[model samples]
Target: MNKEGLYRDLSTVKQQIGLAKQFLESLNSVKFDRKNVLSWFKKLCGYLTDIILTILEIRSILENHVLNKKTMLLYLYQINTTLSLYINTFVAECEIGEALNEVRIFTTKKLSSCLDGIEDVLIKGISTYPENVGNFILWMDTALEKMSEIDHLKEKEKCLKAFSDAKILFEEVLSHAMSIAQVSMSEDYKIIRGSSQSVLEGLESLSNEISKENPNSAMVKLFAETCSNKLCALERKVNVAVLKICLSTFAKYTDDLENIHKFCFNTENKSKPRDLDNLVMEFDLHVDRIMQIGLFAISCSTNMATCIKIRSCLASLEALESELVPAFNAVLLDYCKQNCNLASILKNHWLNEAVLLKRLICEIIDPLAFCQIVHEENKYLVHTLSLDVKANKSKIDRSVTEQVIRNSIVLDDFLKLITYEEDNIIHIKENISFLQKIIREVKAASDVFLPQEQPELNFKVYKRCKILLNGIYSLCKNFLVENSENSFSKEESLGNEQPVVTGNGFLDHIINRGKQILQDRSILYRSNKIEAFDLRSTTLSKMNALKEKNKSIPLSKLVHLRKISFVQSPTRNQISCELQITDIVNELRNMSLTFEKC
Candidate 1:
């Protein structure tokens, strides 16, 4: 054969050896018949060795007479070394693969059988052996790790699917066991026991079997402990149920206390002493009944958990009797002492004190009685009471009429401050401050009045303040716009002057004044007090126009508007105008002089 034919043969042999080595390394389970695989690998190694020997013989023949014998011999030696190394590595990998395959097979078989056994117990409604179940979970986790290590994708996928199915089955068995235990100990267990007794017996037998077979397994012990705890909880629940019979009686006593409380404190109720005495007697009877039931429940309680609950219920009843009832009586006595002539006061409507009493009745006394009857215990109850009194319909109406009149007077005074004769920036700022204060007061008042049944009072004030504030803000914006235009015109007029190249001359003085005006307006524009001014329609329109002209720059830098912080600085428009004025001044100073003999 020619050299090319020999090279092709060597290449084919190398490819075959690579394929055989890959097959040996990829084995993941003994189920693949490791004996036959080993036999095939041995044959492949023998064939590769034979091919290497043939190539060495050919190289020797070529080297015997060739001028390039040294290179040829070197190539043959490299081929021999490579084939030898590949064979050694392939053998070692095959051994490791075989061991891993054995482990995989063993783990998969054990986990499968464990899952099947668990499923059978679950079907029988028997208690699961926690030791076996826990061991199965640990084994499944290890199997997954081993499967991930396996080189053969198909074999790994197969084993992973089987193990995953087994894991799912095991989980289902655990869930079934918990459900059975829960049902056996539930409140309906008495009726269900006749049909489920055999199931519970089977579960007990399964638990015993697990204890005997896997007593050393930590997972199994934990499972058994959990089941025992659940059973104990069920017993406690049953005992507590026996003590819960008095809850309805206790609830009735709370209702009786509530009625007596209303009778004593509620102004609308006909609170005669005879009626109060009768209610007290009725409440005492309910209290005695509650005590009777509480004693019986306490005696019947068989566990600490049940006793604690029963004792808490009885204590609440005792508190109502000793503390709550007497407190209501004391409140009634106080009311009687203070308002002994309440009926006479209500009858005499012409007395000046009677009007104050009427206001107190409608505002404070009625709402307080309502809150007490409804058992409202809000911490803000006092604040709510003050708000409710202030927002009374009569008071709200009177306040609204007075506020409208007062706001009109204030607005008239503010309007008089506005004039087109000169820049009213300072007065406009003051008006803005006053308007903001008024708006803030209106907002605060609205917070209290808006949620009331009648919100017209607050709504009217808010609307009035909003309109006045917007009007003042518009006037301020117009004044600033006209002022800025006037400054721009003055700069234009000064730009036509004769050149003064070096010194600060007449044109320079005018430029400095224009710059100062720009600076002053910029200060006013970015003022924190002006943020409220920005809320006006005209100011927002002007800002939006300026924003469009300087879209490439940030609005904050261009407009000198503070987004989050409030500090005065030059706005973008002011900076741009200042730059223009400086440019005009520089141009006028650089103009060529036209001088005559004068």
Candidate 2:
């Protein structure tokens, strides 16, 4: 025999036999010894058969290519490695049902002598181009060296994908289980758990690898795997939780089938099929993966260590699924029994049957009433405070003074309202005093209105005031700040912005014309009396152009033309409010005079 040539030929034969041996071995370990094991084994074998088909196809290509000496050596290596990969791939491919299993049966049987246990399992080979065989081999060697780092990550990817597949299977089992009895369901449940555990262990181990430095993309993959694991687990948990919530919280008793109907029949929305369809599809996928993969194996178990690890994973998954049942069911029941989130329930109700929810209309009405009361009170407070500030100003920019005061008052009020705890009785008081502080500064600012004050109004006062008002309005509209829809604006009506009111003396005119005059004297109003003491002057609404390109920005930032702060003086609102105050004041004065005459 030619020493070198013979050795090479033998090597080729050795490789071919080695690959075939692995598949046969995995086939033998197909759990056929156990009752359900054969089912799993058969499913796995289906994938293996396809894998073998793919291999034979790829192998045929080797005949067509002419190989040089170096190419031949590499090509021979490629053949065996490629074959091994086909087998391993049963657990490797995504979405598709490829990536055959890692057969560790033979290895498992000889765990005592690991080195000699099965060199076949110990070796990992891949087909490479003749030129790149050196590089491929080197890469694999290096990979093995760093295997400890990526091993977890590799396992995780495998595990996650497997779990995903198993989940699909579980759905089928769960459907059948539901139709059957509890004791019967228990056996199938174990199978689902075992499949899921195999998937999770693979993912978790990978996640732990490079979770620290984010090294190589292993961490990202690890994270993705972890998320997938978490998500899949949560998906199962969600179904369990939702069922529990439905039966107990929204429905009836422990033994009552009516409980299920409570969730199905009395839905908030009218479309039962729409809601159920969505839930069913989502849940169906979740469990199907488990059942489908539970009884399937990619290839035979040729490696003892791999088999041991895999079995351990399968056991863990089964344990989690089977053992956690009571707890999960209890959790759902508990959620339904006590922890009813009104918001969540309402949302679900709406989803279940929106039209039906209309029946509960009055339950949402009182909150609206309270909201209206708050809005009216705010309007009275805002106008009053702004007016008082203007009255107090000395010789400042009148417009500046009014605006500054209004803005300050509004901003303060918002800060108070939003931050105010219902338990805390504090708020930016909507009184004259808060406005008064703004009035003084605004008056001073008004004297300087042109370049400085005008800019100030644009930058500081007007802009700020606009924000505060808009914020309050929006908050109130959302029923976050004030309350009911009709409280601020009429619903089903195209609500209009408060119109711009032009002209001066509007304030003083109203005050003086009041039936009950606090004082009939048209006293000096402003510093030089140039500005009138009328509500109309300062209260006029303006249609300032919003200089914004992006309309989505808050209305406060875009529009600041006008405001209706109710910070008016006693005689400021004319026929509206001031007149009423005046009439009362006059009556009081006349009474005092009568006392004097007496």
Candidate 3:
């Protein structure tokens, strides 16, 4: 028979066997016939064997070009063997139910094996020829539908597991193919256009499959959507790659301009106007390329993704132009200005302009402009600088104020010990020594403020130093006064306690007047009250008063006080007094003399 006639006769017999099996299953036990059932089963097995033999003949005639011919032959052979086994066992034992059960189990196992075979073929086919993924995916759908017709749950589950594995394999193969296409397109678009077109065709086929109402409809739709999204992303990457090419070309032009900048400033050229003009003209030659790249980028900015890339490229261009043009112009202008200055410096050495210009460009303008550009790049720098400066200033102010206050307290303690009582005298000497040490420390701390270059800070430190010095002078003056007064009081008390040489009234009266004069001196010293004085307030008042009196004393002069001296000598009576009183008067007289010398 011809191929078409044989195929039609085989299909008719297979359909008749399926109808007979269904009719047998619909029968009750009361109506069952072992002879009729066995006849139908034999006929079904014979039809399957004929179909397999016919397919093998067609394979030989057609050179095995049909899809899965070997797998179809293997499944048909196994099913036919199971049917023949059931018929042999039934004829020998006359057990219809047992024979039918054995055949059913065998058939289910063969169907499951068939499903595995189809999955294996799909995996191998798609991987070996990814370009034909469309055909393998269709085969998988048909195989799964056929497996679902089995009555056994275990067999059906096995078929479904194989299908799921096949689906994963297909997705992996398609993704790999897409990656290869993407890479090929990046290298040469024209060469890969055919491959990309084939991928598009495959996707179209998958889309058509998704539109159908089938068992795996959701899975197909999910895969199609994933591929579509990937394609869209790949298209964006293409646009970005084009924009990058334009950016690279524009960068080349900027680099050329930078090179020209270097050539013009090369020291061997001697800053000649002719050489600089030639270099600048060469730099201008790239202007056409820059404009072309800019135009291309602008033209490509039609879509949102490409527009973003184009905007980024444009920003880079703007930065380059802004930086390069200004730098070029500034260098030229500064060279001209400095060259004129160099001419005035050495009228005969015009060639030295090259060295001077190079120094100006390298050492001064370039570094300064770079710093300014960096500072302006981020607006946060100015705000952060202001905050840092304010914080540092406040911290320094607090430290300085606290130091001044501590020094003032020390000076106050030193001044309070001016009274020459024995305890006060000892403390007075210790405080003087302590004050000297503190003055050295304060001076060292104030030296830090001097280098600050702030006039207000220097003046503040100066005022604090002046206050400390005046306190020292005031303490010395009060100590001297109190010493002199104590001396005079001791002399008077000694005179009063002397024996009354009552024979001469005038001598007695003179002694009494002398005592009165000493008392008045003590009263005058007490009224001065310099020990309890506020030296800073006193000095400030004196300054204000001096200003009011039109006598502006210099700080140097104000820090020094006039020393008090005594002209009076101890009389014979004072000398004849107790030795301790005489020694006290003598010490005071020496101290006063020392002050006079100073």
Name the better of 1 and 2 by lDDT: 1
Q: After superposition, how far is residue 454 of candidate 3 from its true place, in Å?
A: 99
After superposition, candidate 3 runs with Cα above 4 Å error? 1-40, 49-62, 84-598
User: If both were scored by lDDT, which would come out higher, candidate 1 or candidate 3?
Assistant: 3
Measured against the true structure, the TM-scores of the candidates, in listed sequence, are 0.16, 0.14, 0.16
Worst 10 residues of 1 by lDDT: 557-566
- Per-residue alpha-carbon lDDT of model 3 for 399-487, expressed as tens digits? 44344434344334323322244744664566466556655655664667656746556555545554444434434433443433322
Query: What lDDT does each candidate get?
Result: 0.33, 0.30, 0.34
Residue 505 in model 2: lDDT: 41
The list of candidate 2 runs beyond 4 A from truth reads 1-436, 449-458, 467-494, 497-598
Pairs of residues clashing in candidate 1? 127-203, 130-220, 131-220, 558-572
Provide the lDDT at 95 for model 3: 32
Question: Is 2 or 3 the stronger prediction by lDDT?
Answer: 3
Best by lDDT: 3
Order of models, best lDDT first: 3, 1, 2
- Candidate 2 shows a clash count of 94
lDDT per residue, candidate 2, 63-134, as tens digits? Answer: 334222112222222222222222222222222322212223312222212111122221223221122111
